[model samples]
Target: MIDQVRALFAKNTFLPCDVSTIADDADLYDAGLSSFGSVQLMLAIEETFDIELPETLLTRRTFASLENIAEALSGLVSKAA
Candidate 1:
């Protein structure tokens, strides 16, 4: 999951540092994740996971870091399951 997120950032050329080194709790925004970058990440996540992120899930807190994004995806996957 983290790899997917990192790949997305890498593909967009928005990541500022080693994405693999980013902690799950790291603040992506603080780590140079711009609004546009976030949206791009969101799209990539949706496509990779094959799930639609509802509007309610689109928030700074949810996409704050790779861990948060994974948690959100896990929740959505579980609910679907």
Candidate 2:
């Protein structure tokens, strides 16, 4: 799951650094993730995880970092299961 998130970032131009180099708690926004990039990332996440993100989870906080995204995906997948 984490790898998929990293892959999305790597394939996109939202991040300034390599996905592998980003710290788990690094601020993705500070890493140069623009609003457009966030949306793209969000879409990629939804597609890759096969989960529909709730409106409440669409905030920047949900995509703030690798750890956050993993937690969000874990929660969503568990709920579906």
Candidate 3:
């Protein structure tokens, strides 16, 4: 999942930092994730995971970092299952 997210970021050329440097718990916003980038990331995540993100999950806390995103996705997947 992390690899998929990283690939999306790379495909979009969003972040300037090394994708490998991004820890799962690190804050993507603080690490230079722009609003536009977040939108793109959201779209990529939705497409990659084949899940419609809930409105409630569309918050800074949820997408703050890779870990948060993974956690959010896991929750959604679990619920759907």
Considering every candidate listed, which one attains the maximal lDDT?
2
Taking every candidate in turn, the Cα RMSD to the unseen true structure, in Å, is: 2.0, 1.5, 1.8
Deviation from native of the Cα of residue 58 in model 3, angstroms: 0.5
* Model 1 residue 45 CA deviation in Å: 0.8
Model 3 CA deviation exceeding 4 Å by range: none
TM-score of every candidate relative to the true structure = 0.81, 0.86, 0.82
Stretch of 10 with least lDDT, candidate 2: 1-10
Q: What is the lDDT of residue 20 in candidate 3?
A: 80
- The Cα local distance difference test for each model comes to 0.80, 0.84, 0.79
lDDT score, residue 42, model 2? 86
In TM-score terms, candidate 1 sits at 0.81
Tens-digit lDDT track for model 2 on 1-81? 677677777777777678888888999899888898889888887887788899999999988998899888888988887
Q: Candidate 2 clash total?
A: 0
* Candidate 1: tens digits of C-alpha lDDT, residues 1-81: 656666776667566776777787889889888898788888887887788999999998988888888778888877766
Model 2: what TM-score? 0.86
Best by TM-score: 2
lDDT of 1 at 1: 61
- How far residue 41's Cα lies from its native spot in candidate 3, in Å, is 0.5
Ranking by lDDT: 2, 1, 3
